[model samples]
Target: MSSSSHLIIKNGTVITSSHQKKTDILIVDDKIAKIGNFTSDDDDAGIIDASGLLIFPGGVDAHTHMELPVMGIHSSDTFATGTKAALYGGTTTIIDFANQSRMESLNQTLDKWFLKAEGHVYTDYALHLSVTVVNHQTIAELEGIIKHRGVSSFKTFMAYKTMMITDDEIATLMRETSKYGGLVTVHAEDGELIESIIENNISQKNIAPQFHPINRPIVAESNAISRLVNISERENLPIYVVHLSSAEGLNCALNKSNAKIILETCPQYLLLDDSKYLHTDPLEVNKFVMSPPIRPLQNHQHLWKGIADGHIKVVATDHCPFTLEQKKLGLNDFTKVPNGIPGVEHRLEILFSEGYLKGQITLNQLVQVWSTNPARIFGLHPRKGDIVVGADADLVLFDPNIKHTISSKTHHMNVDYSAYEGLDVVGKCQGVMLRGKVAIDCDGVLKINEGYGHYIHRGACVV
Candidate 1:
């Protein structure tokens, strides 16, 4: 077959969320031109021999906070560094939060995020408007963000009381989102419940980092999720639970009406446990300080079951980076430590090596949970997830035979330590192409020059 039309990925096994088939992919300009046995007729065509390899939809991480401003400090990685890290890991899209502060205007927050991300992303991305105050203007602005900006998801918190909307305010936000054909993404850990526990713990001289998980128990997350689910069911609005960590929390989500609630879990919940924080020096506790803090190991198995059963719709990095110097700010107290971990560059490789190759999930399931499902949920489905005709040729040629151990020294995120340091994975991104241009090649080339990544204006619901 003559391979001269544009770009041809020949003889690869293409895996979509719904189907697995062997085919050749052809690309014209930026979009996928064809997907089948094809022979093109353009002289400048580029050919990628993909025989004996697996080609799945590029991943869409629905939750990430690149260069996000928070808590008197900014996240460690800028948009350029963070998105570049994601591309190297096989993710082609992200949906970051446009967080509204209590004192800041909603428009200002959104505009700030836009400016920070402009000229710095290597992949397509979108935003979810986080409503901090539930006033008329805030509610009014929600429509503008959704209608004009194509942002169809809104986030409100049950936790972070000072930074979150009140229960009545949350209800108002939920109602507004439903009215405008948007989904509500909830961070469901009750602030009041957590506050009472923290006060008691501090009174008892139990102010160490080890006491954090004890203060924010499984019941805290479970009860909050139950309440959110009930509210969602009553409103008949679809709710997405972000960063779910507890088995009890998972049960709360699972027991809800299937059509009303969708759970999103992170790798930290699946891999880390509270045991990591049981240290007297307190510095050791910094590694385990993420929100909805890591739970028991048994919950890990439950999350795998949830992923396999389709109760969990997506897995995201929540990729918030903080360096050791910043983490040290909480040396004497765990409550002050920033809550996040950097994992964008490791999400795909770890899942492929641990979940799929280890027999925990099938190839089809991996494609869905990691790639296609997230795109559909976040309104970037066919364009960002599938390797089909009319889709962008944002592709990754992953080589599963290679083995490597992860460490901060080799990883891309701007952090001092890897949360997943020393973990071995069997696969790596052998090659990555952004719209038919080689962004990273097998010899560990990270070809990131400024202006290579264009800011993409996303669209509304396609799920």
Candidate 2:
């Protein structure tokens, strides 16, 4: 058989958001042409015998920041490195935040991000505007971006008072987003509580990275989550809580009426703990200095429960990365360090080995929480997630039998360390295709083509 136009993935267990069936899938020109015992009539076909593998919609990471400028430093991964890491981990699409600095125009910022990602991205991408300074001008521009620029989501932060919005700003932005039919993504954390604690910690001469976990404790997170939920509910606005890390925050999400709120947590929040910060060398703790910091081991258990029961609708890699040098900029002052971890390359394996295979969550649940729900919530559903006909053929042929330990040596993100370093993960991505092009195989990122990823135009929030 000549191997050219069509590709057949034979005898794999095809898993979708809600169902898993043993089947073969035929791909033609980048769409799932046929499924369920599919056969190709064409002779020019390349086939992959996927008998023992698990096939899933490539992951859609809703919250990531690549080459993002933060606190006098840039994120470690450029759009190219970050998205390439995402492909290795089975994620085919990422909705990165288009950060609007307090002094910059949203238009300028969006354009800057587009230029940064133009020919570098290895996977499909979309933007969610982060409203750092919410005002009339910013508010008025939200709908225009949604209608014309294909940006359908907005993010507001409640924690970094100097760089974020106030309650009044949140209300205004949420109301405006509702008008534009866009989703509001909030970085929920009580600014007052956390700031006060940090001030006290600094005053007490406790200036260490480990103190960061103690300073911005779970109460701060819980307090913010509850307040955001209450405010959005009273205004009849729908909101999404990003990087939910504590039981209290999880409760605020789970206790709320489903019509009003959505919650998402990241792998760092689910796998690592405050213990990672207790190293004898204080600098070592800096690796875990993400905002809404990692919580107690019990919170990990709580988050798993949230995922299993469907209280949390999305699992994403908050892939904001910084090199060790950048991370050490605050060697003596923990507050000066950037807040994020690199997890794009380990999202699927950690979830599968720990969540699904352990029976904490089903395989379908894994597909939904990691890939399908994120795509739907972020307005990239039909095109980015799912194995349906006419959708982009961004697929992952995942081998459940592969045993690997995640580390900086084997990982692909442009970071000096892996938070999941040395941890054994059972399942790994064996092959990845982004929009019908082989971006990653056993060899790694292929230069089959440059600029293969298409910039996705997303739909306005259905809510």
Candidate 3:
């Protein structure tokens, strides 16, 4: 009935955000028209034969930092390159952070990020503003940011002495966000504890990349997480714990002692451990210098168990990439290392290979954590994370049989190295669609639809 093209996918297992079933899907233009059975009688319909593939809603990475500036260096990937890699890796939508400092206005910051993304993105995108300073003026801007600017969630840092806001300020922000129905997502780490440790390490001349994780120990993360969780619990608001990296933090999120809070862990924490910091080569150690840095090998089991038991809600890449040259800024001082790694492109594959295929999580849990939960928590659901009728035709036909080695040599991220280098993973996105258009196929090629993505405004947090 519309002018857009139609397509049909046959003989595939359709995995929705909620469940997985063997079903056929019919697409009309950018929306899924019908799902279940498709006779495929229309000669003009584009048909994809997915005889041995798993269909799922394309991944939604809710935390990424594209073209963001931090510590005097901009993250290597821009919207253009980041989204391209995200698409090739089967993510059709990314929610990148729009950061603002106390010196800047929120409205102006949103405008600046919008200008940076407009006509340069390859897949749909949303934004969550990181509020560096919370005050009367900044709190007043929340209405405009949430309603006019279409950003329904805000992030606050609990670490980074120069950037951290007071607990009172965060409490006020959380209260205001609750009033406006927006979610408060946080990077939780005790700033005072980490700073003191860093000072001690510096005084002792223990200034190597390996010392990076020691300064910010598990307690730093757990103490901060407990504080924020308490605030969220008292305010009766849902707070998202971003890049949760330790057993203590995980326990705080699970609220085994008190209240429950939403949790997100990166693949790096799930798969890698702190031993990488002790690498013989300090430069190699610098590769994993992300905040809430990878934890002890023992914590990996706790995180996996949390995910398995449904205590951890989402898995996001907090993807902020920096090149070796940029990372070397801290060669003499471990504190100077830009704290991030390249991960947007490998999040799904690694999670699939290590989680679902490895029998650690069920298929439904995979869909929930990687796609549905992110959308649901950030308000992008029903549009970005489901394979149901009337939803955008953003989907992936994954070949569970395909095996590939992850390495910097073959990855598309605009970085010199891969944090997941040499990791072997089964299952690949053999085919993909964005809003009903064939974006990538079995050949793993993008159809050159540059700037095809549009800015999507998400609603308030549902969970």
Candidate 4:
């Protein structure tokens, strides 16, 4: 489909982080030109009747890994497939991670990610540099990465042996990145404890998929979060904790640290429990083998309360997917299984159904965590999130009453299995507008093509 210069969406309830109003939106080229009740005399303007639909700012998923190499295999979704699925789910912008290998410099890592994403993604994308090693030269690159490269956040892992760094290294990173207004985001799980437990589990013949969660207990998550919280407090540096899974971990993150601690949780933690590991079929259980694995059922309420109480800041899918064939690599040993699940396509719908429909959070808060909060935190605000005039016209026309069952057969992700299969969800994305163009029409037809997405050069964290 060709891009139209003028498009008007009429009679939709526009929902933002602040308010919701029945309004009309006018788009000229790539910006929202006007909003309110209005009529246009331009006959060439495309008109979309959005009666009874809820218009939302397209979601900004702050954490996603498309085509990432992990555990000797790459994630199933490429930039093109993953972002296309994201757009179908009303997420128009994703801040994916560009992981640095221990051997390569940070610049080389960024260049490699650019090669993977540029002209390949279907939605606007930004990147967070994942720091695997910290040296004098690595520390020196912080200023350029933050100030010049437009990457405002650096990702650190406290878990995986290859990706994890020492506490001293993390402190140095926090101190150095903060000097240039760059925020440090972390996967907070105790690597030493996890490794020790894995050794013990393997020695005792507890190598099944069910033992995956047993190997990395809740204490590991809580302990790491507590350590990071203490460091942030002592150093007066802000930190973002990604994919928080347990109640104990949430408590640690909320432990009154003087530094800013932004919390994030995923739908799996909110809805699914570790009981999934107990399924008789090993293949079925393998689908739940993500790191900082799904926690006990009791943790769900605590996570929901955190979101409702305004403690949790973002809801992002750590969308690294491995096919079942790849999962079989660990059929006998759980540690060989690639960690992560396909979730980019269902984040918005699942959040809307379970969060807003269940009254766990308000619509505004849903919009906040799902779209506005991530954009603001990742420095894509005003341009990526919100429905205000002059903002990029990335919008979703949602039918809140539309109910559907989630299954791998219908999902647009490249993976073979769905982490949320068979779950009934409300609020489907009926139409999507990206940069003043109708990317997904009211009938759910994809009007846009691959390579239409642009790279977003982000700024420092705003919240």
Q: Against the hidden reference, what TM-scores do the models get?
A: 0.95, 0.96, 0.97, 0.98
323-372 in candidate 2: lDDT tens per residue? 78888887888878888888988889999998888888999999988898
Across 328-440, the per-residue lDDT of candidate 3 in tens digits comes to: 88776797898899999988788889998888888888888889889888888888888888999999899989999999999989999999889999999998899998888
lDDT by residue for model 1 (253-288), tens: 778654377889888887888888776667667876
Give every collision pair in model 4: none
Q: Candidate order by TM-score, highest to lowest?
A: 4, 3, 2, 1
The reply for model 4, stretches above 4 Å from the true place, is: 1-4
Clashes of 2: 1
Query: Which segments of model 3 are wrong by more than 4 Å?
Result: 256-258
Per-model lDDT: 0.80, 0.84, 0.87, 0.91
lDDT of 3 at 236: 66
lDDT of 4 by residue, 1-463 (tens): 4356888999999999989999999999999999999999888888999999999999999999999998778999999999999999999999999999999999999999999999998899999999999998898888998888899999999998889998778889989987877888999999999999998988998898889988889999999999998888888888899999988998988887485789999988999998899998888889999988998899999999899998998999999999999988888789788889999999989889999999999999999999999999888888988999889999999999998999999999998999988999988999998998888888889998898999998887875
Best prediction by lDDT: 4
